[model samples]
Target: MTAPSEPTDASAPSPGSPNGPGTLAWRNAVFAVFFISGLGLASWVARIPAVRDSLRLDTALVGVLIFGLSAGSVLGLVVAVRLLARFGAPRAMTISVATSSIGLVVVGAGATLLESAPVVFAGLAAVGLGMGSLDVMMNVEGAAAERAIRKTLMPLMHACFSLGTVVGALLGAAASALSVSVFWHLTAIAVLVFLIAVVAVRSIPELENTAETSAPGEPASTWRSRLRASLSVWADPGVLLIGAIVLGMTFAEGSANDWIALASVDGHGFSNTAGAIVFGVFVAAMTVGRVIGGPVIDRFGRVPVLRACAVIGVLGLLLFILAPNDFALYAGTVLWGVGASLGFPVGMSAAADDTRNSAARVSAVAMIGYFAFLVGPPVLGLLGQNWGILNALYLIVALMALAGLAAPAARERHRR
Candidate 1:
């Protein structure tokens, strides 16, 4: 198969041929592995309360400790591009995946042995950074792959991630029910992740440099210039608008993924199995949404779809918050999942579509937007601790509405 040019730019004609029907099978397989790896990570988080309780930690301490993962991810995002630039996407992704696998195993091993909170937290932090680096590089490769193939592929790929989460949660719940050690479960997942990474490594294409052409004597961008250039790309009216859209999308998703289980158990009074199921259903809905998202976005355009998703998400959050019973809780989760599914995929697509510096542009928008994920959950957890789960649900509603408001701004950027 032909490879894309180095520093792949969305606007450039790909050096490789567009992905044909013949190649889609292989591409989908690649999506499955990355998707599953992400799902496993999400599943690990869902089981944290059990791990925490096993170690006899309280809610407040758990919140502080959990923040370590997001902190590590943020750190990795800062260095992701430089690493990818030096190693190429294939090598970068492979190495990062390996890093994440090690982290996963570490968490599981610690949990199995009932490691101290400090040690567990450190392991989680390492996992977070590895996942963050892997996430950025994968998306960069994905966008390049999409451009080379001249079609939208991100949604389906991401849909796999959602699906993987759903599956992982189910597996985790089963393991939890059986009183299996968390460490053993995580180690099994790590083995699977490693195998998937080994298989996918061969399929990853090396991207070419399609960045701006400089004169023969023109000096390369200094570190200062490079930093400014990265910042300026996001400073663009179009890019900023996309960042808002992404921020909103992430808010909805991060809220749902991080807290749905907690809400089900603590707020709705469901059994732990039932609570885990709540998360599973939400992820299941999102997975379905991702699968169908690309075709819908292509047919209808990004703006209208995003607006609809936001409205639906708000309605779902309200339903979730107001629900007096488990039936309503499940229904609300379905709504939230459906509404959230499109945001990340579509937002990333918009960023790629609008900017010439596709990789950096996508990265910048993500860097800004994902802070919502890092910040939103802990704040919500604190708020839940302070007020109650019901009140915290209201905050989720507000964030989703804010996300919806930014949709039009993103569209306007495209028009310009």
Candidate 2:
């Protein structure tokens, strides 16, 4: 409710805190926004089976439709460069949430009342578009809040996202078991998610602060300069290196999200329930790692932690790929989860370290990571068709090593 100002509260823990006087409120609000985002995401994913049945589509059709979401997400990130320059974080985040909410409703309507594959695909695209920009903005906001607190909060904040996904997945399961219709279910969740985002945005204090500024204490002209500045982040080798770190880690995480169960089932010869359980183990490991990561980062530092995680991930992934027994398989899954937990959030934090460049840098790094999420799975899928899923995952292991090589790029940005 207050504009950005000097902290008047003498009792404040830090001098000139970036969130002004309401840093705690802003931090909690950011947490809420991140949590609701996860809910919105999982709500759709959890209902895929029911949606497929309702739309009378085969797995092939569903794959094609899912491409719409991935494609839209990539496109949305491109749009985000301008939006961040034009609207800033709070407004852009709000718009993105609204877009995602409306897209969910459209998806619900298409799947239930209309039963048109094209309509559903369009809806998925919209959802992806909205959530994509949202992903960048929220991470930007998270990095801001982390700076305000003068500590490592991004990891725990991301853990909040993981927490949201777990809750959303459970509620969705409950809805399905109760025979809740997809239209009503997605529609209701959409409304809830939208409202949460709207309320959460009120506490953010960024305004158009980063929009007009090129870097800390540097300014840009009205239109062309801003556009050029935003695009220039793509050329910044530092940002690109950080992005590389994110790309490998995200590919590892996304692959797990898409293929862990199947890999466990077929490659390791686990039963259906066991495979699902293995995937669950991975999720739990990720959640735990994120929740604990803040103190670990603060105590040790970003570079060392990231390198260790990369090594752990590579080891875990190798075990999963070449596990000779049940113990090796499960351990690998958990280690992979732990290894992948901190890269995305930590990279965002690093990108946003110089507040002036935060928006463009965060968006660029996010684009790289998100692309891995959207594109990596399918690449692995095609490879898995011939080389086997276990072999396909080796690609991720090599990339993870690359990510390790790039970890130092995410160290604290030198202030000018």
lDDT of 2: 0.75
Give the TM-score of each candidate.
Answer: 0.87, 0.76
Error of 2 at 332 (Å): 3.2
Highest-TM-score candidate = 1
Give Cα-based local distance difference scores for all models. 0.70, 0.75
lDDT (Cα, tens digit) per residue for candidate 1, span 293-313:
777876877789899998988
In angstroms, give how far residue 244 of model 1 lies from its true place.
Answer: 2.8
How many steric clashes does model 1 contain?
Answer: 9
Q: Residue 47 CA error for candidate 2 (Å)? A: 4.1
